[model samples]
Target: MTSDQYIIQRKVNIVELGATLGNISDACRKLGVSRQHYYDIKQALIEDGIEGLLEKSRRSPRIGNRVAPEIEQRVLDYALEFPTHGQTRVANELKRKGVILSAGGIRSIWLRHSIEKKSLRLKRLERWAAENTNVLTEAQVQALETAKEEKEAHGEIETHHPGFLLGQDTYYVGYIKGVGKIYQQTGIDTFSNVGFAKLYNDKTALTAADFLNDKVLPFFDGFGLSLLRTLTDRGTEYCGKPENHPYQLFMHLNDIEHTKTKVRHPQTNGCTEKLNQTIQEEFYAVSFRKTLYTSLEQLQTDLDAFMDRYNRERTNQGRHCRGRTPMETFIDGIELYQKLVHKGELMH
Candidate 1:
């Protein structure tokens, strides 16, 4: 039964129990409900019968908590105008138009109207245009056509072992007093949360290749593992016509397949993006001001120490890992995959 129906039935049971036990106070105490609440239920039953025990919606019709109708309409119009924009961008656009809305509030409206994804929204608009072609303006039809033609890309990569897939990306870690400008190149194992990061004075194709060779490859090699693939964005540092990109050349030499994210879709490389955010909040933001680094070597030294703690000490609460550290999860995944292979249930 629905929760509301269950609650109504429970109230009726409580009233009956009070009558049977010959004590309203005893029934209220046993049911953990206030005596006043028991009386209210009993009175409702006396006046309106069983229908009165049915729970009504608590939502207020004229409540100020609900989004204003005009504001919601403006949000819908803005979303239609920019079909490719995510909730954050939509909320920012509304803010610029003097319609302040939190991302959660905007998402709630989108969910209420079933505008979950850009592609879904575009499809709805296309249907509307098809149905009202005679009434739609020229500009409205053109907007619908453009949205329909836009490609909708969604992808997810699964890793069965630690070296099955790796996601790499670079982030600007800000300029330090003595270190000048710093750029951090990071790589994370998709199956395990194990990550490696190196700070460079500049972000270039050569630096990106060096980070993979000097840090990422060597770390995996120490564990007697080989990376199957590396995923990155189409930044100049990691992409080109393939022959000229140093990072691409490095991957080719190592026998690792290099995969780039879809154009304008950074969520495809979300693993490294999430790692960058974690490092920014947990490491750089907390330690950058507190620690004094006189040279690049010093910063690199501290960064290496932090990476050790991140891999071996910090317990990951991810769904796959539970409370195990990244190293522990990596080892567990390898063991499970090996057992499955031995049982002839999985191919190597």
Candidate 2:
């Protein structure tokens, strides 16, 4: 029977019982229904008959406590940009951008999208980067080829040439007694795994732009290669209004394209993230235990030495590295890059 029919019959049974027993209170007590409820059912039966006794369902969409469409879209965009961020972080980040959303509201939205976990967010980033490869550099086309295999199993990203895609990220190197907090701006060429790093006391839009201007772009320019695109996370240091933000403005002036990882999905820029881990494990872990540093310059001098060995001396087992030094891989790849240029695949 329909729910309405079942409810109507029950109401009828209660009214009939009251009449048969000749005591409304006795009928209600036996049925385990309250007297007031029985009276309400009787009044409904008298007024609108059986139809009035049936309960109505609230089938329409709820109005109150619902998030606005624009706000919802912003939340989803933020999720894609910073997939690793928790609800509190997302809310705080949005607030800085003039979007007011509570952590609970952000969590509710995340629950709906099924990206509440970091892994799901990273998966969404992988899917997004795969589907929207056009936004990525042309040199990154081979990454789509990597999709045939298990990406995580293969480890680092695959690139076409030296300037194909540069993975950039910020690393916190812990606080020194006199230096306060030391942040390292790190970059790596995905094709050759050639790495570059510069130390900074603070991480900001200016510092991010400066890393490229001083260390990254200069190295590529010295080799007469075009730095096509850079990949990073959606941090304020790397992203903002083109005219107002130093990093964005620098990119615009330099004619370099920018791409970013989904929020909390650092592996989208895996080359740099891997380098960060390596630097921490191989260099910082060893160096910190051996030396007591009081100045940024003192520590930086030692870090530069390590970076030199990493690029030119330390052997690597990267897919493109093939058990050669990063500098060797970078040098050998130049010929392959030039041949592609001759084939008209790359600009002359």
TM-score of 2: 0.55
lDDT at 263, model 2: 76
Residue range with the least summed lDDT across 10 consecutive positions in model 2 = 145-154
Instruction: List the global CA lDDT of all models.
Output: 0.75, 0.79
Assess every candidate by TM-score: 0.55, 0.55
The reply for model 1, stretches above 4 Å from the true place, is: 1-156, 337-348
Give residue 159's lDDT in candidate 1 (0 to 100): 70
Full-model lDDT, candidate 1:
0.75
> For residues 1-348, could you state the per-residue lDDT of candidate 1 as single tens digits?
987789888999999899999999998999999999998998998999888988766764546677989988988876664454568656755665688999898888888789978667665655554575434444433322332121222345667777878899878776655567778899998888899999999999999999988988888788766777888888889887668888888888888898888888887877778777666644653344234456778878888988897888665655566667788998887777666557865422
Residue-pair clashes per candidate: 0, 7
Best candidate per lDDT, number?
A: 2
